[model samples]
Target: EHKGAIAEAGGVKALVDLIFKWSVGGDGVLERAAGALANLAADDKCSMEVAVVGGVHALVMLARNCKCEGVQEQAARALANLAAHGDSNNNNAAVGQEAGALEALVQLTRSPHEGVRQEAAGALWNLSFDDRNREAIASAGGVEALVALAHSCSNASPGLQERAAGALWGLSVSEANSIAIGREGGVAPLIALSRSDAEDVHETAAGALWNLAFNPGNALRIVEEGGVPALVHLCSSSISKMARFMAALALAYMFDGRMDEFALIGTSSESTSKSASLDGARRMALKHIEAFVLTFSDPQAFSAAAASSTPAALTQVTESARIQEAGHLRCSGAEIGRFIAMLRNSSSILKACAAFALLQFTIPGGRHALHHATLLHTAGAPRVLRAAAAAATAPLEAKIFARIVLRNLEHHQTEPAI
Candidate 1:
């Protein structure tokens, strides 16, 4: 409330002005001024006000001009905080659009000071949400800088490790950037980071790997970097639901037939060993994927949804099984339809994963749950769910999740599309 009052009283503009005025010489006061803006920027209301009061431009100036590590760290942090106000704000684009902001932050990622490096990586990570900013950062050498950061920070603080991997993860969202990351010797570091005991570090690493795995070459790089077992470990053992989910997705993408030829790579015509290894990896991945699905299953709760069509039981199960953060994940109708098609896959493991992903998306209270449900409903997904649930060959977990998805769709049948 006091923070809100500060913004109301024009404190943000005053702070921005103070930073700019004192930043003339990289004075000690300028660092504190920028730090104050960073703190205020953590609040959504104040963050928007900061942008309105010209704080974005002011902070960018400080970041681009300040030579002191202390000032640079604070400025990058302010930029990151401004960029992270729970999303949907224009601050992200503002930061990216601020001339020299992305370059300055990218250069700061190479800072000798860990705090400066961490904050810069974080700023890049947040800004990469925008497509134009994402590619621009890569063009600014964000891919190489961040991959190097990821490699060198393995022994650094978890914050640095997480942010380093996160920056790469953000850039890897694009196919070109993903391929660039893999080719720039990023796969090995990310795989090593994925084995970190820190949940956030491993989670970010898994996310990057997931994005990179979209490219068959990168997927093969992950395999060659010994990422398969690491990803499988994350899918089975990570405490974070997002980590497990993305790890499962990464594994799915790897074994999803596109990498079939890559898995057959060998030095000579005598590639029997490679074929055997591929078969074993597939079985292991499928087994763990099935196990991941079953982890969310409670026979008693599922029995309730199975017994009646009412939403009470299904809602209860979804609530119990829901990953609250996953609700924030939005996908295109084509993406949702891909999972619907997967329900007919001959591989029961893929079918189960598809159902599991659908359940995650349509859990009712997610930011995009309604959007996903509408997409599924429009795509005629209910028919697929019914067939999947009734198929004798379907895994029990898949059958159960498919029924739950059907119930979720039914509950939304009368609601207006979001």
Candidate 2:
């Protein structure tokens, strides 16, 4: 009923003014006011209102200035709720950014009070959804702070590790931030979290590694930090679909251009060749390809699941297949058929991924694997590729790659019999 009264009385602005005015003098009044703002911000309509009236600034100030841990926690919660509201306006995130909320939130992440730390981490996780906010967090030294939080003892609350890893996952999206995270010695901690008993921590850590893998240099750093075996273990053992998905994504990134490294595993006679290590990673990846496909078959479903937990963009599906193809990983005819189906019915992203995977399968190194699968002739793959090449909405990279695949498929078909 109080919530309804607040909503009736000019909504979030009233709450913001009360918070600002009371926060200066009365601890009891400030806590109540911040708590009200947190509740109001949970409602999407009130979130935009809160941002418009400068409530985000008040919340950040309250969190920063409050001596009471409870007040700080509540203020952080309000900021997080506002950021998580997900209104198209993005005003909440913008206001928080302008108000210097990120720096305050980063400070809270280190608070001795566990509730304060958890709430601050959660708020940063929400704010990190904005690319600019991510850059700001990283620029403000949030990456090292977050990594320290995530590296806390195993007995620590799972929520702390989850939120810290999640924020790191967001920071890892930018190439420069990815390098910063590696430079801060974040890779080993993240890899360690992947082994946590808490599924959320495991999943979030995998996600951070996935994003970090986007930069080739970071990918190598991850590999050197023993990330490959850890990810492979998660892919094979985890019950959470998201965990397995992220594990596969991390592997894909780590091995993207290192196909020849894995290939060397089979032919090299030198006992000291890195092939032994590469071989284990390659076998694990090939073994889990079907699971990866199942996990990503419906991009929308996967995206929805991810957003429910961490509110980040989905991993590019094509990268997974491209890496597998680069390693000359073979697929069954049924799997090729699935790619054809995706080409026909999936979104442009998946279509491009499928087309490119088929393209790789036609290369000389990959051709022998497809001998048993008539994907080019019987499955109408060429028709799908040609259509994708001509589609208006297809990404230019997709279209060009599709055309190249079609041309190659045609050449393979028209060649004289030996």
Candidate 3:
């Protein structure tokens, strides 16, 4: 209420000015002023007001140079709120970068005060949403600092670990930062954090792994560090839908071209009595494929719900049912049609997963399965596959898989129907 009143009266500028003027004074005044700014920054209009009056610079300075931990904490929180506010112009992020805020935030990540560290890490996490700020933070040694903070204490508070891992997740978007994180030994800590008892830590760590896995070398490093089983475990059991989704994405990246493994498993089980077990494993794999297809089919809705910071209960239930249904059913024209539709999804992840699943149908036995089910002749499947294969935004691996599916489909088209 007070914050709304302050913004209504056009006192945000005055509050930001007071923050700068009172910083040299004792902690009480500085803390109060910073707190006020933090509250005001929560509103988009007031955040813009704060940014216009050079509030970001004042807050960054307090976070950097203030002797009082409380003041630093409040200032960092204020900067984080401003950076996270929905500003299409991204003015707060730009102002922060201009003020050299990344370096100071990186320094604060190492602060002895946990609150300060958490808030600073959160600020970095928000700043990292910008691609340019991502490069800036990475060059400022933010990746190494974040890795250190993530691993600072095995038993660190969840808030600290969550924000640190969240920052790492944001940083991992850059290929350079992904390589830097691996060089800094970031994989082991992330693997360790994925096993954290705290749900937030586990989710953020899984998310970081998802982003980092985009780099082949980093994916190999993560698997070498036992990330595969950890991720698999999270996908199977974690209550957080985001965690499960991220783990699945990491697994997808890890096994992008390894169709041979699926083939080997599908064919290796020769025991007559073990057929049920083989079927169960195949069903499980199908379930995962179906879940990915459904979730990424509409990326905008999924992103908005996930961005709300809510638990994954609704998504889990919806996707789980789809997975179960897909698992029970064999390859069908309807299923193939769904995969073809996913080829046109806005999300690269969805397009990639759909391509990967379709690739499975091109394998030796997989081709036979699709032929028997008449899934290859599903109307427009070939055309859609060709389009997705040539899509500019689809991942390289997705395009490759799509091209392979199209080649196989072309071969089938040339053959006379039985």
Candidate 4:
């Protein structure tokens, strides 16, 4: 299947030929052909076949020249499906690299038809995973378009809300785009969307908010827009563990003692009635974050990591808490260094949060775990981790995570260099 048997089976060439021959007339032939390719593009194995058979050029032609909404939706869906296989193939960047492909998809986001808009946004979302495509989409006015979509989609289907917010989430991974999204009024709709009853909607919205929260201006904007309580709700109640985890991280970054300067909490003089409400919001965020981390801890497994000499025991403990998606989270060495510094910070909550972030980054088998472990090792983290583990005042979870980190370091560093 991965060999793209469709080409051998002759199906891919047939669909591509049909798409190339059909014009954008009233007939549904072109639409059906594009739609069939779209369906095939969703299969990882068949997707390459479609591409190899010149399907991308055919689909991009339809996306560009076709006036039919049906054809447009199918073409965009096919592009989205094609871009979805980035991990296994080059389709993500390949889609964007196609002539007029990125701009065409960006145009499709403004489609009057909701289906076209959703598929276009999803294609951009998937495309945004590629570094070049992420910046390219923004250059194509994607930030403003997506923010407007978020604003207008308030009453639209949950599917629309999810994609609109998701597209923003993908773009906001970059610092510049994160700020751009906030300045373009992206944060308000995301905060609204985060309160949705739809799990997919709020989960994606929470992700956008999480990235947006990394910037101080956006963090304060979130607070000004009443995003604190919304995030607090997701952190405490979301059925999706990833949603809860991200909401907690957003709050952590907000409360990591960085935003105290604003009059949001109180003026420099410190009002008798503090407005920041840091006491309750910070407490709630930390409580749930700690809870989220502990959910992965098995007392029995941790006992071995904590007491035994076997590296496998520690590896078990580390993997026990592994959130595969968290490994995809990229943090600079500066961020890792800051976490090391937080290990001995005055508050145990910050220490625990720091430990949690490091644990996520250092778990064995993660995409970036080895990179993170290397950073930790170079920072002379073992001594600091030993201190955190032995600190009399450290929270139990913090100490547990610190030990896990130490063990993880011991385990990964000793591996044979490839």
Candidate 5:
């Protein structure tokens, strides 16, 4: 009846009384009270009542107590609910004066129980959503704690890893947290997690990588911390399609500005040689386009391939062609080169990929290569047509690919001097 009455009244007074009991009474009663408070706090009415009855201080106390896992989780959840209201127009001043609230929440991130830790991480994420709270989290080693959790929990439950990684990801997106991630030895663990056998782990790792990639300095750290190799391996992993896509998308992002860095891998003699020694090994990095094209045999696979490639790299070549003359082409050229190399099993899909990759090249020299390749196709160049017709099994798509190839060449064709 008491529980039902609390629920009926939206549980405000009961939650407040329970939180008071937890704070002042302490022990079995506190645990029961904390749980009741957590349940009641789920309703704004009850949460408001608890807030009025010193619930914030009580929850903070539970969070700081090392022996109370159940209490800490309940406290974290209650605090999360309260902080979520910090954005309310009327409660701004009240929340601002909730001294030690942020500190207590940060402490819960270190809770022995994963549930409390994840909830704490989530609450911290919500709190840091505010610029003011972001500064506070940064000052209180929140980023460091989140990153540490991410690293330590890499092999734990995928859910816990994800929550920790997601928190780190959110933190890393901020410049302050990005630096903290680097300083706290977080990049290596994220890179390692990116290579995990679990799809969820890989996705969380990818998100973390994406957040870190937002900063050029972090991108460099990712590379120096051995992220590149792990990402490259992920690109070719037969594990989860989503993981592969994320790997590809991330590599594409890295290559956007760090094209030279990729040159070391793409143009490596060992990669290009494709010697008998690697006969049974997975396809080399230079052959990524070929691998992508092969996957097009299945529509689902094609969709996966598209998802994996960067959107910036997916734009029509004709569109990118105009600006291809600048630094744009340099990046495009590398992508096109890889696309061409991947076009071994030619089809309209392969042609489109090749054209899109080539379109990024605007330099006269790059255009000359594209022009040459196109001409060979126009002159009924068997190899050129075959490469361009990679997706030719689909007739309409094939015809379109042929037309695009011819038109691309026609635009580049240099007429004899008058």
Candidate 6:
């Protein structure tokens, strides 16, 4: 309430002044201040107001130099909030200023203390969302630092490795950062993590692979370098239920990425600013998906046999009576159409996954495959969408999972003409 009053009393400036004085006042004061700043930044009004007061610069420095790891964590969090808010505007100048702030953050990414470095990597990722910050991060050698962190995870504490892998995954999602990640030897480390004995390490590795899969070029490398087989093994593994579930979720995203790229291929499309890269990416993605399907279809006789030996692991997959595995397991139009039909079943999780899988077909140049193959149109999709929307408005537990469905429908709707 007092914080609300401070925010209401004089807007963002009051909070900014308080944060700066408290943060720079010394260890205890800085920690207290960082806490307060985090609270304020959580609210958009306060965040935008704080951004107005050179809050970015102060938070970045605090994140860099603060001795107390807790204070640094809070400061890093505040920076993430601020960067998230600023990057949303698409304002070049605002992003450029934030880029300058990221330079300091990159330094902290290599901090002697592991926790501080983790927090710093997360902060850099938040800032790097925008083009300006992406350039800034690349310039500051973020790619090298993140890769090194992932590599050292084997020797580092489990908690530190988890944090480090997560940060690298965040950066890997962006196109600019994807190139850097590849150049910095991140792929091998990420693939290696998929097979880590630690559950946390496995989850982090899957998350990184999901991010890298966003770029079609990386998908084949991920498969050739053994990511898909490793992840498939984990999904079918009996080691840990949670790890298997996460691996399944990550593969869902990777599969969606491949389908999305395939849909963008050769539509005789007029060249737009996005034409070159998008088209190239689509071809690469199609090749990767073809290879993945070939291997996944016959895992026992596939190229990477070690990663495919998961019959023991397959028993661990908790299958619901309501959800049936695709018997034909083909990527043909009829197969996809049947999959969409399965989504309308009463189970929210089933519906959500189906909706997402359907979204992959909406990209463009791929309409012909579905047109002849039994894919559902927008009219057929709305029923599942309405179910998801209703679920999203229900109580919290039901809401989060349902939101995923709604988001997939919305993403597909954004390019309706395609």
Error of 4 at 128 (Å): 0.6
Give per-residue CA lDDT, model 3, range 205-284, as digits (tens).
99889778766677767765877667777876777766776677676655543322333333445444334543444344
Candidate 2 per-residue lDDT, tens place, 25-129, comes to 788888888888889888777777787788878888898788888899999999888888543658545745665678888998889999899989898888877
Candidate 5: tens digits of C-alpha lDDT, residues 263-300: 23544675555333222222233255335424433444
Candidate 2 residue 113 Cα shift, in angstroms, is: 1.1
Q: What is the lDDT of residue 240 in candidate 5?
A: 61
Taking the tens digit of each residue's C-alpha lDDT, what string does model 1 give over 215-268?
A: 889988888789889999999999999999989988887887778787666665
Question: What stretches of model 4 exceed 4 Å from their correct place?
Answer: 1-5, 24-27, 262-280, 294-320, 324-338, 378-380, 416-418
Cα deviation of 295, candidate 6, in Å:
18
In order, what lDDT does every prediction score?
0.87, 0.70, 0.71, 0.84, 0.57, 0.55
How close to the true structure is residue 44 of candidate 4, measured as C-alpha lDDT?
88
Of 5 and 6, the candidate ahead on TM-score is 5
TM-score list, all predictions:
0.92, 0.67, 0.67, 0.89, 0.56, 0.54
Please tell me which predicted candidate would have the highest TM-score against the true structure.
1
- Please identify model 1 stretches exceeding 4 Å from their true place: 86-88, 265-271, 307-310, 332-338, 374-380, 410-413
TM-score of 5: 0.56
lDDT (Cα, tens digit) per residue for candidate 6, span 301-359? 22232233344322221111012222111233434444455455444444444443443
Q: Give candidate 5 misplaced runs (Cα > 4 Å).
A: 1-10, 40-54, 65-67, 81-97, 112-115, 233-246, 258-418
Best by lDDT: 1
By lDDT, highest first, what's the ranking? Answer: 1, 4, 3, 2, 5, 6
Over the stretch 157-178, how does candidate 4's per-residue lDDT look in tens digits?
9988899999999999888999
Q: Identify the runs in model 3 with alpha carbons over 4 angstroms from their true place.
A: 86-89, 258-418
